[model samples]
Target: MKRLRLPIPFSIKTNMILAFLGVSLISILILNLFTIHYFSEAVKKDFFTISGEAQSRLNYHLDDYFKQIASSTSTLLKSDLNQSWLSGKRVHTSDDIDNIQMELKRYVAFNFPEIIGMFLVNREQRIISMTGNINTDSLSYRNEPWYDLPPNDSLVILPTHRTAYPYPQQNGTPVLSLLIPIYSTDDLNVTGKLVIDITFSKIHDILGKSALGKTGFFFILADDRIVYHPNQDWLGMGVGRTDLASLSFDREEQSSIQYWNGDKMLVSVKRSTITDWNIVSIVPFDEMSSGLKAARGSTFFAFMIVSVAIIAVVPLVSNIFVKPIIRLKQVMQSVARGDFSVRAVDDAGQMEFQQLGHSFNRMVEQINELLETVYELRIQEMHVRLRQKEALIQALQNQINPHLLYNSLDIIKSIAYLENVPRVEKMAKNLADVYRYTAKYAESEVTIGDELTHLSKYLEIIRVRFPHYFESHIYVNEKFHDCLIEKLTLQPLVENAVKYGIEPKGGHGAIMVSAFQDDAVLVIEIADNGPGISEERMRELNERLAFITNHVKDKQLPQESLGIASVQARLVLKYGEDYGVALHSFPGRGTVVSIRIPYRSPKIG
Candidate 1:
């Protein structure tokens, strides 16, 4: 599964702008939310306050209207015509009773224009002074609940009901009734009842004159029934069946918000002390908050405009801040591509940018100077290598006279053969092979097998010279025979073992040569059993080997350690610091020289 990577990576300028805008937007959003919340609460409080005030006004108006009705009823009770009729003193004949009835009707009409009709009933169950239709048979006044009320001075206000007038214009219209019980002046016994029918139009007029919002309207509830509503159809309906009935209405003057039919409404209630009725004003929440809604829209539009302005300005501001950094980056990229001639432009007005540009220019100048010095040193090293190779070829040319020495060795071998000296002839032949191998110095690298063959021939000549002084052993693996190695690498170590380790120890020592592979490297060990180097001298010799480059350049190899130092230097030059010769020795025991090099087999192609 491959990992997904972003197509366009985020840059410093973009991140900085995002951080700035994020903080700004978050802070602004929080402030706006708090402001809107507080504004909404304040508007709600104002709505409740206005509803409460409306309730107060409606209550006062209704109270005054009821008071006027009560005063009119009280005045009619004291009228002479009403008392004379009740006592039956002024009505002996029908004509006399009719005159008294007409006079009483005129006075009531003139005094109370709100009263639509008036009726009087006597103790004998006889009706008189009836200005509107009065059904004598269907009156059933005796069975009426108001008719049996215990004699009380105050007039009793009744719920609205339809009139039974025969006149089409006056019949079936709802009216409020006021019942006044007549009593004898001396005994206080109830003798008759005075009924005043007040028109429903009067109550409607009072409520219709006032309002809350567009949809706000008032209704009068009496005895849990809607006595007066703006919608005539709702009149006489039970208050318990309407949405308003679910609201709390215990107080004389109260207001609250409630949901009705899924719409929020503000309900204000005022109870009338005169009629024991409630004047409820209902206004919708949306109507009441129309202005606030408009304000909210305007605020949102302004916020949007500000947000757009911030978005447009943020990039410009971030660019202003990052421009100098961008210029420096471009210069650095140029420098990385080896174009050191380019320098960061110092056109930025800020002091920091100017200083940074100057520093970058100085650094590039120093880098260029250092590169020139390194280039010169590399050229000198190549020249020295070329001279070394030339010197090796010239030394090989000087050994070319080695063919005359070979001829002379052949002559001696011939004489030795005639004298029957087999050892001498064998010695001469081995010496000739050694000379021929040494003459091939131009070959810097050879197969380990070839080098080992030359080493065996050289060892044979040494063994003949030393007789039983030393012995040599070769334990290299055949698999590594074709592996390439530096020419004369093994021969030097073996020569050193013979001259320093064996010959000095009375020519009685053993030399062992072994080669093997360790991972990706080949290791060769040359071991000798002879008087070994002391600890102090070995330390000095290893230190000299470590600085072989300086030793080669200064021609400072010590005479006694030249062979070992030369081999260590050649191995280091051929491979690297990791491939070199290491010496391990114990005084009076033995010495071992191990060479480590990268393993390589000859390629066929």
Candidate 2:
């Protein structure tokens, strides 16, 4: 598979924005993670501390309730009914003892509302005194575990069991018993055992009051057995079957997290000082960490909002930072294209960018000033070169004048001696006319008619010198006779054809000078049927001409093509780059030199 790429090049602004957002998002995520972790730990710590405190308070209340039961037992032992039974002095008959026991039961019932029933059993007398309704079948005093204990004053707390004679208000509920053995004062012998039954409902009331957080509750355990629980089904079950069964009850109070009912929970255990039972408070982990979870959610939401804000804000900030640079780049591009007038604006938002813009503007201004100076220098150099070329042309023309005058005088003298007076006169007159025209050089531009008239006279002299050696033709329209052109423009081209083309080709060639109007420009072409320029030489000459026109100051005129280069330079000086000379040549055929000039009528003096 081909990898996809962006169509447009990445810009600095986009890159900066992406980089900033990437860093910001990562920071936000990290901060949010840490915040959530810290928040969760803090909430868990607070929750456990609160639950442990609640369990401790409940244990204290339950311990106080058990102490009240022990105190009630002590009070009963000090009662006259308990003393008389132990001493064997209060009653002699069964009728009298039963009446006294009935009165004692009423007194105990009126004093302790939590008690379900009370019983007094004597092994020596083979009798039992009981309070409330009794079931003889369930009340086996002789085989009871507490009855077998060694005689003692201290009370014994028994495990919870169903009461044999449950109070009507107790509704057949289970009860926790406290047994106090009665002993004789003289012999310190075991006389009787007083049993006080406390209903499970009272313990339930205490456990229920110790409420934890949501979904938290308390249970009472006696020696690792659940004695009282809110759920009746858990009551009487071994503590090992429950969630908190693994808890070590070595300490007076402890708290920890454990899996309860297949769910993690925060469990706290507080031991009761009275019964050595544990008050276990359980709060499911989910419930205890609810506040932490909410805090995490809130932190995540805030992070998302901040991340989005960073994403949106980064681009705008990058743009604010990059806008001026973009403008500066555009201005620099313009300057590279030779538009030195352009400059960067100094209105960037940042101080550094503003300074950069100011520097760019200063650089452009300096470049523009240097370019203006260079342009003026180039114009001055062109003027100086043109003056030098004109001077050289004048000197060449002066050298031609004396040579032609001498040859013309020799031809006239010879013709005169040969009795060819008319021809001699014609030749001499043309020679005088050529000399006169060459001598007059005041005007820089002339009409085509005047230039052509001078050219015809010079050609007539040339014909006189070498009759039938070369032929010349002019095919200029009369309408162009008044058209303005550079002076001596056509003369040098004709001279070149006669000397280089016609003379080199056995002095027998045809030279044609033609003029025509092409659009707004006039074209003067000089064609010669002589030994033509070779393809290589023509290309070299054309390249030289182009170089001269393109780099006017750097290129020097070729020595062999001085006349042609001079004409081309003058024409460019007058008409600019668009109007110049062109050469067309073919080997062993002919050469055509065409001069292109903008057509304009001769200016009046």
The window of 10 residues in a row where model 1 has the poorest summed lDDT is 393-402
Model 1 spans > 4 angstroms off: 1-37, 48-51, 84-100, 121-151, 164-171, 181-183, 187-192, 213-215, 240-252, 259-264, 284-291, 316-605
Whole-model Cα lDDT of every candidate shown, in order = 0.74, 0.72
Candidate 2's clash total is 0
Candidate 1 C-alpha lDDT tens digits along 258-326 = 787788777767677667787777788788777767766776776677677777887888787688888
**lDDT of each residue in 213-314, candidate 2, tens digit only:** 666887777886777888776665676787556665554455566665588776667776667777777777777677667766876687678668867887
| Residue 67 displacement in candidate 2 (angstroms) | 2.8
The local lDDT score (0 to 100) that residue 451 gets in candidate 2 is 88
lDDT of 1: 0.74
Model 2 bad stretches (over 4 Å): 1-41, 73-75, 79-81, 87-92, 122-148, 163-172, 181-192, 242-252, 262-264, 284-294, 313-605
lDDT of 2 at 71: 67
Give residue 434's error in model 2 in angstroms.
99
Give the TM-score of each candidate: 0.44, 0.43
